[model samples]
Target chain A: MSLLSRKIADAVSAHPQKGALTVDDDRYEICLELRSADPEIGVSFDGLDFRALDASPRSVETLKAWGERLASRLTYLMEPLVVLEVDRIGTEVELRSAKPSVRESQLRYYELRLESSGAAHLRRVLFDRDTRTRSTVPCTLGAEALERLVEDFTATAA
Target chain B: MRKIESDQNRFRQIVRGKIKSDLRKYITHGEMIGKTGGELVSIPLPQIQIPEFRYGQKNGGGVGQGPGDVGTPIGRSGEGDEPGAAGDAPGQHLLEVELTLDELAEILGEGLALPRIQPKGRANIIEEKDKYTGIRQTGPESLRHFKRTYKKALRRQIASNTYNRNDPIVIPIREDKLYRSWNPIPLPHSNAVVLYLMDVSGSMTDDQKEIVRIEAFWIDTWLRSQYDGVTTRYIIHDAVAREVDQHTFYHTRESGGTRISSAYQLANKIIDAEHPPIDWNIYVLHFSDGDNWGEDNRQCVSLLRDEILPKSNLFGYGQVESPYGSGEFFRELEEAFEDVPNLALSEIRNKDGIFDSIKEFLGRGR
Candidate 1:
């Protein structure tokens, strides 16, 4: 258990409903909101931000995994999130997903939103070129699934 | 007058033909929903020119009689040079023609080639029609038979030797009054009741609701043309189900989990209470994104197979595609009710699929 991982696990235990914790000398910020019965984690890295969706109460292991993975690849993970923020101007955001399987004549992308409280929201976007319409839907991705998505997205964006 | 009526009928046929040709576009775009007023809808048809004499503007100058010189520009220069401004020219506007629900239904049936529905059970509505059966000598002035009373008065005058050839004016007195008497004849009418159940959960978007609205409008129109009396009921559900008006059914949105069986249970209760199978032809049309709770999907299947399907003349389930909804319930229904005769299922991907979905439901003609 490193110092950073212990800090994250402590934050998770302290703010079961709604709270925020900043660590790594103000390099990262994590906000928790559990009013919808599902824990939503909003992560801010430096100035760029994205949401880590589908965090469960039993996510201490997931938090430790994130700590180790995020320590080295924080810049790599943010490339896609930054691109998503630029792409999602003047469009509706529904929900977040890591892997988006688009159909024919469809364009799939991601969107990021930075809240006033330093929390960030990441949403999956599916745009149909034929109809010129965009849609997003809530996708259930547990903490483990989100870790895998982060790994996959960073590798793909790289 | 007969010739004028025949011309009007011809004009109406042409209008119907124009509407039928554009029916698919109208169904997909849903432009007619906003123009609906009560039992009539105003359809905008282009290129149907009505022949009429165009009167010139009062006191308007002729082409060469304007104030400008022969080579000078007409009126003020740069008058219409503004960018993106409304043009002053007489544009060809869409001619809005009002058609009754019955007429629109006929057009839809003809356009889709939908078979006429055979109403089930007994005639539920017994309407009383006032039929003139006899004549009475004394009654109220509203029902007085003018010609008969005049003839009676003329006969009385001639019988009493008071009618003159030069000035033959027949006066109808109280004794000569004849009144029409009528009996209330009971007319048997086959009726139907349509139960519209919609999933208004968070997964169901405004676009999906609009698609459902367009489809429902067409369905309502078609069914109304089939039966003498058609009563419509709307049920909206997320986690819980409740009955609402037509406006609320298409507009309401609730952020909750989906339990499709709740809507089915409410529909069953409504059917069992008001519309008995023995007396009325019942139709259950449910629109959802097919995102039911894992356990509730089974409950929905069982409820449909046991209660709703058996009582309904036709059971139509339209699964509208949504990115959020898992759409597992549609597959469940397909696996469960694959061979069910009255059950009609359709997958509406978007607005373009409404035309085919309507055909799939009404084509059964149950």
Candidate 2:
């Protein structure tokens, strides 16, 4: 298998719920959805509410090829995945969770609020259950950061 | 009206964005060329979302409410009897958007950062044009202005106190007749002529021709947008050279020795006879597999240096890679004319290389 296919397979395996990746021949619809859980990131295919998990090996290979093709066309997949919902009051930023939380989470929702302090950009991972718990941390807004966060979240659940 | 105009402008911006992002892909592919109309080309963009409404299940108060059986067929019988497995994913859609040649050229220029061309010599040709910019008292019946004539007659009647409040009938006399008058204006038009020369020898494959075709389409689009009138001439050569139409230039295949100078000679002859350098912005573009005969490279260089390069605004030479060819002609051109201002040379190894090759050729925008 190619390195891209292996990466996708690893991503799916790390998730707590079953996950599937579907990509069409023309690469118009490329989506990765998690079944039986509220996914941290959900790609809508034609605005249809659907879940696909336990994809075949052929589907994984097709998704890898599609990803390569899209990259050649200079279209980055992570740009669409990183959707930020920002609300600001004065200088304080209130970042709301754009997507629902995964299953088996103690918190009802989690928001990654980012704000600038002097030269450093600080973030607060706000967990809302009954009472809100905020943890200030340093984070960078990039593909690698998002990937690491998702992996860390899944690892904690596991 | 303002809101609609804003919405239309927003949609146009989105389309331009899509085109700009995929400009390189379009340059490497030739499928869009076949979908081109007179002044517009249709491009298929993937993953463009369209707004729609989705309905949800209502409360349990409708018909067929009594669920007494399980594993029974609900509606039609052969609904799910297809051969393939049922796919739960939504199908992909390609949205076809039509853009004018001018818009496509603008996107290409912005994407490639190509400079605007400065035509050399007397690029503009002045032609006398008649424009109706004034109204006169008398002229031909075909040029008569009915509205102006009626207003003039009404004013004359009101000034002479011949108007009636009840009748309000004002007839136009000879003196009150108004006609549209035209002045001869000298309109300057910039015209361009492109000479496309390609080697269709045995070493050149259909894939190489496809790359050339895609590149030529973009070059044509850009040139046509820049000039008021653009003329394209195609020349195909193997061991000999002959002028042909666009279709024959791209589709013809010949197996013989390569003679690159023959094409340059014919192009020079055509330009000298028809398109003078002073009056037309001439562009000579040549595509080949860089497999000229061993003895003809010197002749080709001499011909280009003495005849073609001096008269043309830009001379672009693209060398398409071929397995059978020796690929020595490009080295000769580079060694001979390393500092020629009008000469642009590019090596296109594959379809993807076409994007960079086009930029190299038109980047200077000579």
Candidate 3:
């Protein structure tokens, strides 16, 4: 196993479920979760929660491969820093931009969700400030773009 | 004149129908809220026209059939197609019809099937209004009764042998001037006060505040229509709570942890000082994102149970959804205050949820 993956696996074994650890790179805070003997890893940065696989094994090599896969997908996230949040309730996963766009009085945000089956979906939302109305549209992201988002969410800090 | 009045009444009915058909859109979208002016709101209606009489000139020329040829083209057809500067006259436009608040409230009531609120207890507040009782000899010129003064002048002219019976002309002097006088009468006013408490913490965004704003507008509109005198107060809270004006209540934002009990405490104090349960019909609406400091949730429940709900005719708690909020406070309240008639709890997902949330709050007719 790679040196970094070995360290993460050791840290996960030492800490309790839902515990956080800043490994080789202190810039990224990795959160470890265990459900039904399967591991879920996430990262917290800039008060925003991001990245959590539905389920995986606690293998050191698997952690390394997943981290590398995420790192290779860093193509999106080329804009200014905006707060985002990921709160998983029950089996549903909700990852949304916490800071909405302040255009005129209207606010807009992008939200991504992962169903229990691990399928990802995206939505573009618009909220009218004057009227207090909201409208949402389903959106699509290319495979590479989705990968880039996963990469940015899993490892990066802003 | 009667025919013209009848036509005008028919036109008004048409406008009311159009407004009623689109009332759901207005309530859900809040497009009419910004158009409110005093007690009247201007609504834009399309495809409605006002009838007018078109007069023709006495000497206007007309074409004779004898001079027209079978193959003749209309004069200057090419000239009409030529490009020119924009015309001075305006093009077709949407008509804006102004409806009073009472009228709008009636539309809302009928459109949503909302039951009219029953005022609790007897009317306790007294409002004094001016009644035009009689005429006086001396007063402000703006209030002068010209018709009465002219009749008085005609009577005096005939009595003094200065009347021109054939001409029938009478001019009034300064001594003939009369003014309208008023007497103050106290009437019982059914008074209601809506105490609005909002959580302006970091978790609550402008979007959520906007939902609060739209809901508040509808609630205020319905309550104002029900009560003779309705007074509104605004309170904003983060970790600390304070009373503010209406403008500041919706616009203000603070980046601090939420302590909902602070707002309830202030509302309790306000009720004790200005509005007593016996004399005032109190409505307490608290809006938050359902995020609070862990220990503060218990305090908020206690405050609601002991202080706010007991005094309020209806206590509505709306949890506006926010991305940053944990949304645990809603469950806590539901668990603590199950089946409490005076307490109404609703979860507002977004702007679209406002219509039903308002119905839920006022449907009780409290």
**DockQ scores for all the models shown?**
0.04, 0.01, 0.05
C-alpha DockQ for predicted model 1: 0.04
Cα lDDT tens digits, model 2, B144-253, are 99998999999999999999989999999998898999999987565789999999976677989998999999999888777767889999987789999999999998
Rank order by TM-score, top first?
1, 3, 2
Model 1, chain B only, scores a TM-score of 0.76
Which residue runs of candidate 1 sit more than 4 Å off their true CA positions?
A1-158, B52-86, B129-181, B185-190
Q: What tens-digit string does per-residue lDDT give for candidate 3 at B1-366?
A: 698899988888888888888776677776778999998998888767776676689646765675658787868566678688889998888789998888888888887888877777655457789999999999999999989999999988999999998988998988889999999998757578899999997678889998999899988988888888888999998777899999999999875457788899999999999999888899999999876664888898999989989999999999898753336677799889988888888889888888788888888878
Q: A-chain TM-score per prediction?
A: 0.34, 0.22, 0.37
Residue pairs in steric clash, candidate 1?
none
TM-score of chain B of each: 0.76, 0.78, 0.75
Residues A1-158 of candidate 1: C-alpha lDDT, one tens digit per residue = 33333454454445444333333312333332222223255332212233333322323233223323433343333223221111111121222223335667775644444332223455445656466345653333433333444443233221
- Cα deviation at A22, candidate 2, in Å, is 67
Q: Would you list the clashing residue pairs of candidate 2?
A: none
Q: How far off is residue B1 in model 1, in Å?
A: 6.3
**For residues B290-336, could you state the per-residue lDDT of candidate 1 as single tens digits?**
86654778888889989999899999999997643336677788888
Candidate 2 lDDT over residue span A1-158, tens digit each = 32333343355445445454432221122234433222344322111111122222223223333323322332122221111211121121222233333334222222222222201111223232223222322222233433343332222211
Clash total of candidate 2: 0
